[model samples]
Target: MPQHHDPGTADAPEGQASKSGFRPTAVAAVELGVVGQSVGVTVPGASESVQVTGISLDSRTVERGDLYVALPGAARHGADFARTALEAGAVAVLTDDAGARLLALGSDIAVPVLVVAEPRSVVGRLSRLIYRSQDADLPGPSMFGVTGTNGKTTTTYFINALLQAMGKKTGLIGTIEILAGGDPIPSLLTTPESTDVHALLALMRERGLDAASMEVSSHAVSFRRVDGVVFDVVGFTNLTQDHLDLHGTMEEYYRTKAELFTAERARAAVVTVDDEWGRRLAAQTELPVTTLATIQPGSGPEADPAGPAGADWTVTDSKPRGLGTEFTLRGRNGTELRVHTGLPGAFNVSNAALALAMVLAGGADPAEVQAALDSKDPFTVAVPGRMQLVSTRPAAVVDFAHNTDALARALAAVRSPEPASKVIVVFGATGQRDQGKRPSMGATAARLADVVIVSDDDPHDEDAAAIRAEVLVGATDAKEAEQLDCKIMEVYPRDAAIREAVNLAAPEDTILIAGRGHEVWQEVKGVNLALDDRVELRNALTARGFTVLQDDGIES
Candidate 1:
C-alpha cells in the first residue's frame, strides 16, 4: 500500500503461507451469495457450489480452492493476471464489470466469474467472511489501531507491549514487522492490504491471542485496504506534513485520516491534542472519544474546560527521571495515575500516554497498563530505530525521520540531554516521494543541528545527485538566511555519510543518522541491497575506534 518496496525485502513471499497455512475454512458460492447480491453479481454454472478455502488479491498467491480478486489497479488492470490465477488452481474469479470485460476478451478463461461493483471496498468484508464469522464467535483478539504522520509504529509497539505486560498474548502490525502471536514477521507495508489484515486477524485468533494493535496509514485508509476493520479503539497521534503525493492536498489527507474515527471504522477513539489536526479530529469524531495530552498549553492558545479534549484527560505533572521521564495523567472524573517511561523526551511521553489511553479504552485492565508504565520494571517497549543510540562517547543515534517535522523532533530529542552537546545530523530524502519535503527537511536540519550531512536515502531510479542538489538549495537558504554556523557537507553512500558524521563529532557531541529505520535493504534502481543504518553506524563507529557489539548479546 505504501508503494511496495521489492518483493522479498522484509515481508514473507505471497505464496509462503503461515505454518498453519493461512487459508481459512472453505466457503461455498451460496455462502457468499450475500456478497454477490450486495453488488448485483451472479455466479454462473450452478456448482452451488465450489468451496473456496482462501481469498487472494495477488494471482501469484492463489492456490487451489481459492477465489482470486481481479480489480483495476493504478498501473494496470488486475485482469491481466487472471490467466495466472487460473493456472494456479483458483476455483473462480471475482471482478467488476471492467475486469469482466477484460476477461471476455480472453479465450482461455473458463472458470466461474462473479462480478462486483467495487472490489476494493468489498474485498475486506469478503476476507472477513472467508476467515472470521463474528466478533464474538471465535477466540479472536480485540483490535486497536493507531494512525498519524509519525509515532504510529512506536505507539502500536507500546500498545502491544502493554497488552503483553497485562498477561495477554498480543499480535502486532507496524512498519517494521508483524507478530501474529508468534515470532516477528517482516512487514511488507505499514498497513498491510485488507486481505492480509483479515488473514492475520484469523491467524491471531488461531494462536490464542487476546489483543492486537495495528498501525493504520492514510494510504491504507484512502485505498480501502482497511475498509471493513472494526477497531475496538483507534488512536490519532498528531498529524503533520506527509504523504501529500497520495492525497493530493492537506485537506484530503486530513479527511482520509478522519475516516478512521467514524463508528464504522472503530468503536471508540483516543486523540492527542498536541497539534491542531488532532484537535480538529477529536472535535469532529462521532464515536466515543477520549483525549490524551502529554503537554499543557496544547497546539493552540485555546483550551476547553468542558469539551471532550482538555476536559477528559490532561497531564498535570512531569519530571525528567534518570535515563527516562515521569508524568501524571488526570481524568475529568478525578481519576489519576502516575506513569514513568524508560524512553526519553516529551514526544515519547505523549506516545506512552496515548498508548495507555487507547488500551484502556479497549477494555484492558487499568492497573496492568499503569504497572507496565512504571519505570522500575524491565523495559518492554523499545522502538527499533527511533532515537536509538549506537555509540555512547559521541552519542551517535539513528532515527526514521525523513520529513521536516520528524527530523526536527529527532534533533530536539537528542539535544534534550544538555545544552552544551552539539548536534550533527546525516540524512537524505527518498527518490520520487513527497519531493517537497526534501528542502523543508534541509532547512529544519540546518536550523536544529550544528552540522548537516546530505546523503542518499534510497535513490530508486532518479539521478541521486539531482535530488541532492534540490535538498542543498534549502540547506544553503537556511545557512544564509539565519547566518547559522552550521556546516553543510554532501556525501555519497549512506554508509560513508555515517562515517562523515562520526568524523565530525567529538566525545561530547551528538550524531544523528536519520531516515530508513529498521529497513534492512536499500532500494537503488530496482535493486534492494543490504544497507541497514544500525549496521552501518555500528560499523562506522567500530572503524572510527569505538567498541561495537554484535546483536547476539556479545562483542564482535
Candidate 2:
C-alpha cells in the first residue's frame, strides 16, 4: 500500500525563507502524500524525513527543499548528478534500489533517500498527487483531446474555433502553443509534463474558460503525462507508423495510445475508423464509442458499421475548392449538412467529422454543432503548417507529414488535382529516433515526387549526414531500373534544401515540404534555433519572384 505525507506536519521553521514563487502550502503537501517513514533504504540518512517542496528530474531546475529524481540514462546514470542536485538545494532523493546503494557510500550529504521499485512509473503519479490533488476545484470546462498519427493539430484547431464561434471561451494546447483564455504561449512538448498539465488546468479554472482542446501525443500517454486529468471526450483521427524508436513495435505503440480510453479517464470516445487499428480499438472499449469515416470509398466491408452505426457520422462527396474544402457530413439519423473548411487535403473531412462527433458525444446539441459549422467558414482556424499551401504557380504545400503513411497520403492528396504535375518533395528523418522508418519515408517520397530533397530534421546528437544517408537508402531501393527519372538530392541544412526545392519548382509543379510542421525551432545537436518552414518558404518564394496566389483553403 502507498502512503502520502501531510504538509501540516512538516511545516518549515518560522524564520526559514521560501524560494519558490508558489508558496509551500499545506494544500500541496496534502495533495501529494510526501510524509512517511523510510521504506527500504540503504543510505545512512535513509531513515530521516524531509519535506519535498517540488519534484524535478533536471538538476538545474531543482530548488531548495525539492526532491531530485535521478533516472538512469543510456550515457549516464541520474545518480551521477545526485551530488550536483544536493549542492543545488535538493533536500531528499528518490531513486531506484541500485541508486540507493550507490548513494550509501557518500558520507557528506545526509538527505532523506526513498527507494522505489521503478521511479519512472511512479514519477507521474507522484507529480499528479503533488500538483493536482484538488483538480476538481479547477473550473469545469468542456475538454477535448485529439490523438492520431496526423491531423491532430488541425482537428484541435477546428474544435477550438467551433467552440469559440458558440461564444465559449476556449484554450488550445498542442505542438504549436499552450493557449489559455486565448493567450498563446510557446510549447516545449506536444503533451506537457503532468505537473505542468495540472497547473494549466488550474489556471484555466481561474480564467473562467468554457472549453479547452488538447493534442495528446503517444509519448504523453506512454509517460503518463495525462494520468490524473479528466477529459470530457477523447477524439481519435487516425494512427500510422511513427515513434518506433520509443515504442519498439507498432502493437506497443497502439497499446500505449489505447491506455487513454480506460474507464478512469475519458467519459466518451469518438474514433475515426479510417484505419484497421482504429476499428480494433473501438471493439475493445466499452465506452460509448462513436465511429466516423471520411474515406471516399465508403466504409469498407471489414469496417464495423455496427460500432459507428445508427446516428454515427461519415463524410461524403468531399471536394477540394480553391484554398478550402467542401463536404457533406451525414449522421446516422439521416441529418445531412454542408461544411466548407479551410483545411486542405481529403483527410481533413475525416478530421472534421471526428471533431463534430466528439462535440456531440460530449453533450453539445447536434443542432448547435451544425449551427457552429455553418456560422463560419472552416478556414478561419487553420492549423499553421498543416497542408498549408504557400504558392499557386508552383503549388507548394508545407505539412507535418513525417512518416511513410502520412507522406503517402499528402502526396496522393496533392496529386489528385494535377496528375501530370511534377511533384518535388523536401523531407528528412529525425536523428536518434525511428531509424527504421528512414528508408520507408525516403521510398514514399521518391515514389510520389519527381524529385526528392533529403535534409536534416532535429538531428539531436547524431550526425546529420549519416541520417540523410539512411534516407537515401530508401530512395535508392525505390528507384527501379525502369523508372530512373526520380531524382534525389542530399542537402545538410534544411533551409538550403528548401531553397533548392523552391528553385527547382516550375509553374504547374508542386513542392511538398514534409516533417516539422508549425514548429518554430530547429533542434540541432542540443540547441533549439528559431526556424519556421512556412516563413522560410515564403521568403524563398519572394526571393524567386514567384507570383503565386495563396490558397487560403488549407488552414495554416
Candidate 3:
C-alpha cells in the first residue's frame, strides 16, 4: 500500500511486461484530483495511499497493484468483484456511490476506495493517465479513425493496408481483431473499452508500431470509450438508420459520430459526402475536411451544397472486375490517382479513396500513397466478411451487410450482368438491434436479388421467427410496391439457409450470404455457437460437388 514511488514506477517483473508490451505506470490511489477536475467526480472518502499500477473493469484480468474500476454492471454491481479483484492483487478500488456503499459492508476493505458520481465516464481519463498515453515522451501510435453505419470495418482495414503498404509498421483495431503490426489479436467490441484501448495503444507503441487504423463506433464515442484518445486522421463513411436503440434517434447518432471529428478528437479528416449525414458532419467538424463522393461529386440529387461536402475528391471511371476494380480517383488538387483494388463495388472505391486521402492527411506523400496502389501488391487487401468471396463456379460470396444500406450495396456488387444467372441472397436480421431495418433489408434483397432466403442472425433471446417476419414484411412490401412476385423462403438455422441458397443456385448464378461475415460465432439464447458465413458457404458449396477455388492468401 506504499505510495512513495515514482508515478512511472513499474512493479512488473524484468521481462514479464515486455511480452505483452505492458509498461506499468503507478499512481497513488489516494489522489483523485485529476478525476475531480476532469468530470467533476469526487472521492468522498478519506483515502489511504496505495500504489496503483494498472486499471481494470473486469475482475478476471486484474493484475497486482491494479485499480479495479467497479462500474455498475447490467446483471449486478461491479463492486461485487472488488473483493475478487483485490484478492487477485488489486491495490485500490474506484467505483460509484452505490458500489462504494456495497464495499463498505466489509471491514476487510483496506485499500483506498474512491466513489465517483460517474465511474464509467472518468475511467477513460484515469486509464489514459495510468497507461501513460497522456505522457509527452511516449509518442504513441498515429491513430486513424473510421466511423459510419456501414463500411467502417472495410475502411479501417483499407487504411491499415495502406499504412502498411507505405512501409510503416501498423496495428488495426476494429470489428474483427486487433492486429499488432499485422499480427491478429482477437477483439470483442468494435471499439474496445477505454482501458483496453489506451493499453493497446501503449502496447503498440512499445512494440514499435508506427500507426494504427481504428474503427470509431458511435456507441464508443457516446459511451466515452474513446474519451482520451486522439487521432491523427479520421474518415467518415455515410451514416444510415442503425443503432437507434442505443442512440434513440438519428440526430443523436449523428452528433455522437460528429464527436470524433472535433479538434479534440481528430486533427484532420476525410469524409465521403455520398450521403447528407456525411456532408452535414463535414460542415460541423472543426478539423480540415477532404470530402469524397462515389456518386455525383458536386451537383444533383446526391449533393448537399448547403453542408460542408462541396466535394474535394470523387471516384471516376470506376470499373468493377470480378472481385477487384480499377478506378480513376480525382481530387480538387488536380491529382488523378488511378486505383486498382481487390475490393469490389463503388462503395469500396469510395473507401479506398477515403483511405488514400486519410493517409495523405496523416503525412504520407500523396504521390507515394498513389504509387503504393500501383505496386504489384498495392491495395490487394481482402477484408474478411466485407464482400468476402468464399467460392467459385456456383459462386458464393459472404458479406457483413446486416443493415439495409449495406445489404443493398452487397447485392448490387454481386448481381453480375452476364456471368451470373440468378443472384440468390441468404440473409437474416439480428435480434434486439434496430428492428426498423428488418423490412427494409428484406425489401432491398427482394428488389435486388433473384431469390431471397431469410434466416437467423444472433436471435439473442428474441424468437427468430418474429425477426424474420419483420424482414419478410419488407420483402412482401417490395413485391407489392413493384407488383412482382419474388421468391422468398424462411429458414430457421443459418446453415440450412446457406445450403438452400447454394442448392437453389446454378453454375452461372451467384449466392450472397449476407450478415455474419467474418464473425466466427452465432449468438443464440445467451450462448455463442461457432458459425461463419464464409466457412458455411464453402462447406455448402463443397457438399454440392463443386470444387471450391483455391484460397489465395494475399488475394480474395
TM-score of each model, in listed order:
0.91, 0.82, 0.90
Winner of 1 and 3 under TM-score: 1
**Top-TM-score structure, candidate number:** 1
| Alpha carbon deviation, residue 169, candidate 2 (Å) | 1.9
The C-alpha RMSD of each candidate to the native structure, in angstroms, is 3.9, 7.3, 5.9
lDDT of each residue in 193-299, candidate 2, tens digit only: 66556556656656677888999999899776787777889988777889989899999989888888877778889888767788778889767788887764444
1-556 per-residue lDDT for model 3 (tens digits): 3212111112222222212223333333424444444546454455433455677777767788678888876557888767777888987787888888989876579776777788887888888877776467768688899999888888888888887777889988888878876457666678777877888877787778889999999888977889888888989988888899788899999988888998888888998887878877877889988888777445433455553334788777877665778888787778888887887676777787888778877888878877777774456687888887777677678888888888888888787676538989999999999888899999988998888899999898888889999999989888888976569888868999888988888888889988888877787886777787777778788888877767622121
Candidate 3 positional error at 144, Å = 0.2
lDDT of 1 by residue, 1-556 (tens): 1222212113343444433234334433324454455556765556435676667788766777767898777666888788877888887888888989989998768777887777777888887777662357565788899998988888888888777777788988888878887777777678777777887887887777899899999988887778778998999987778888788788989999999999988899999877768888988999999887766763322333433344477776878786567778788778787877776556777787888888778876666666765633423356788766676677777789888888887887788366577899999989978888889999988998888999999888888998898888899898999998888999988888888888877778888889987767787887777788888888788877875534412112
Instruction: State each model's CA lDDT, in order.
Output: 0.77, 0.73, 0.77
Query: How much does candidate 3 score in TM-score?
Result: 0.90
Query: What is residue 4's positional error in candidate 2, in angstroms?
Result: 30
Output the worst ten-in-a-row residue range by lDDT, candidate 1: 1-10
